[model samples]
Target: MNPAEAGPQVERRNATAACVEFVQALLERKVVEAVLVPQHVPGAKVVVQTLVTDPSRLEDVDPVAPVLMSNSATMVSSLSFQAPKGRIAAVMRPCEINALVELVKFKQANLDDVIVIGIDCPGTYEPKDYMQIITAHGGPISEQVFESLSRGETPSFDGYELREACRICEHPSPANCQILMALWGADFSSGPVIVPVDEKGREAVDKAGFQSGNLPAHRQQILEKITSERSARGQKILEQFAQRIGSIEGLVDEFAACKKCMNCRAECPICYCRECIFCSPTFVHESNKYLKWARQRKIIKMPVETLLFHLTRLNHMVTSCVGCGQCSSACPNGLPVMELFRTIGSTVQRIFDYVPGRSLEEEPPFTTFREDELEPR
Candidate 1:
């Protein structure tokens, strides 16, 4: 269910059942060439990205299936520019959608040929950590847990499976989706399943023969209580964590455990680059340069780019950071990547009074200049 919905109307449904019905509708219309979503891949213990072209293949369409797999925005960027495909109906979390919008503004992706399918952010488990739990449990525990959770049960924190970044997520739903798979905590037996955020999606739903009904009380109460609690918790974390890592020196100290492992950037969907400049020979300057730095400074961090990479990367994409939490998820050191990036990203975005992926018409701050704006006071 979309927690962003105001005044709290609870809508509930068996997300799996809704998925089957939704995919069937998409298949019949053929408006989308394929639906890229998650499903159990064969005998694998983890969920993998599956492309469904036929309605029969939509059996395991668990809308609650967490995509803490790989970042999809970079893949979309590559698909948008390098290999243009037919219209795709792909479900993305808010971060992915927002990252895609940033990519489009930066001329990284072409948005005209894709249909966005969004769902409410019910939080997610980190990929590697989640897989570990699945491995320990002999297989994926997602389906069972989701079913239980859907019925209004809060599951215990299963080891280190939950992503650290998710502990503080604020915006969980994609508000700008053309087609939103609304999951209000309301009883699913009588509420809207596929709520269209756009007219095209509305027409599509109408053609699919869906009828809206009154939301349920039980579902609404669950959503409101949960989201409200989440927001308060997030604010507290911001305040507490801020006290520790609020300055440049403190920031570097917080990142002291990073081991120069570019895992964070590597996992970030917005950090899409076939050849990172830092990874190039230009950064691999003569050996004497390192010695000179060591001679001058007394010590050189082994990975060389201990501070520059993080800072530059933050500067480059903070305006586009969508708070997907994948960076911290992919980190081996468990550094709070989303917390730092989003904290800065939020400031940068607000400077322009912008929210990424919320619109296509809005240009990025770096791309276009105003003739007469932000004049001297």
Candidate 2:
């Protein structure tokens, strides 16, 4: 049977509970050796990724948490790159899966023994904001978020908004995954729809004993609506952002507050370099070289190369950027790093007709050349 045509046959009352049950089944049935999922911390309101081998440890699991503490692609890379003993299933949001796809292309992650169980994301909040919102509500609001998504609406928290990166995300539904817990246009009263995107996903679902059926008729329609809305919004925002950074002076002014902490690079999942050129001895200039630069320019930013750092990074990874916005979140000075990258990335990606993470078969522009491309007659 075509897995894409198969959907969940079981129904449950609670979406979160249903997901927990499904994941637990994966373990109980030995579909995978371990599962990587998000669970609430014992004494804190924050949620982080946890590796579960024992099914009983999944009591605190919340696969659709509204917070993003860190992009999990780096963690996935760490886990799968070394070729672990057994297969694992990772429950990730759409963006994280997309980032992982890019990492696989760069040889940073191996998906051979991995099963990607993707979840639909309405959007996510910065961790601090999520903590505050949930605290004000007196508990987790994941159910409420899922409910909103089922109605094909963006979930809203009182006194807070989603991260700008999420607000402008074009891909809210999972792709390039084996299994998907589809929420868009769902009747969450019956729980999220479990969708098998390929044969592996179908086998996993069958092994876990979930029956097969057809997906919600309106699921694709609603997903397209959401993507269209976000793409239009993203274009508008990126256009304005590009104008703001249109000139060198403008770009420098926007990034003037950078402390050169490298937090953005450190948090970026696509930046897989073991040692960045900026951190090399070449950039550890001698006092005379600094003096020469200062004398030549007559004036230069102290702790120099801040602008250059951003430019160099953009050159290196812009094509692979998934726009997860961890860089902006990681920035202590609050520079709009995500916006800058997406604005430039969209242009460069368009020129090459490439969308990072869209498919494993499509090569990154930098890694491929075309004889008839980008030439002057």
Candidate 3:
């Protein structure tokens, strides 16, 4: 029997089962040596990226889970850096896939032997918020939330909702991915529609021997509606941030609670520096030096480098920010650092007519120069 037919009866199987079966076929046939996908740990509510070598271990693998623990691009970078002997298949969200594209350009990730599988995102919940919702709902959340999102309704449990990042994301469908598995805006009670973005994906599907079909016409309308809604929401966020940080006082006020703990830097996918300047001795000073600075100002903030640290990071990474919002999720103070970075990033990227992680052929703005580019100075 074909792989699709080998699963449960056509009427009973859902999209999640179809997705798992597809990946299992690849593994069983040795089309790829390992698969990098998210799976809920046994006896845990959290889902994490798991590298599965055995097909039987995929019992808990879920690509459409509403919880995002971390950006998986860095994980892919670590896995493929040494030029692994066999091909690897990875399932990632749109933001994670975008980050991987940027990483590929920076020589941090090798995609020549990796297959990128992207899914139509139905947004995600912040990890802490998701855990709370799961506890209140009293069971696994993937199916429940997926059902709500499939109908274009936001999942709500008590007062909880989707993450701010997901609420305002403009790119819901994956772009520049080799294979795109779609669930949104489709009646997936039958099976998923596997759409190939390139020849590699077409070849992969052929090898897997799964049934495929064209996307429903309504899929385009649904995607456009979602994108438009998200764009409007994103613009509102940018406008609010602009008002909040319109001046030095406002900027400082917004970040006044920052502890200089470097959590944002640590979680940012684009802030990939082994020895970041902020973490180095550049910001470290002697006791007397701190005293001297305080004496000069008569009163200095206890942690002196908060503003400088954030500004420096913005300068270094704003062009590459993919709006993944991991930084804000990692912030202990709950400062909206992602908003600041993305707000500035969108403007900077626009000024240079560049969109980070959109395509491999597009060069980063800072890497190129033209005398006439910024004539006004």
Relative to the true structure, candidate 2 reaches a TM of 0.94
What's each prediction's TM-score? 0.83, 0.94, 0.93
- Candidate order by TM-score, highest to lowest? 2, 3, 1
Q: Assess the local accuracy of residue 120 in candidate 3 as a C-alpha lDDT between 0 and 100.
A: 80
- Candidate 1's C-alpha runs over 4 A off are 1-13, 82-85, 132-161, 188-192, 207-227, 371-377
Off by over 4 Å in 3: 1-13, 152-154
Give one digit per residue, the lDDT tens place, for model 1 in 207-244: 66665333334655666666677668777776677777
How large is the C-alpha RMSD of every model relative to the true structure?
6.8, 6.6, 5.1
lDDT of 2 by residue, 60-109 (tens): 78877788889999999999998888999999998899999999998899
Each model's lDDT: 0.67, 0.88, 0.81
Worst 10 residues of 2 by lDDT: 3-12
lDDT of 3: 0.81
Error of 3 at 314 (Å): 0.4
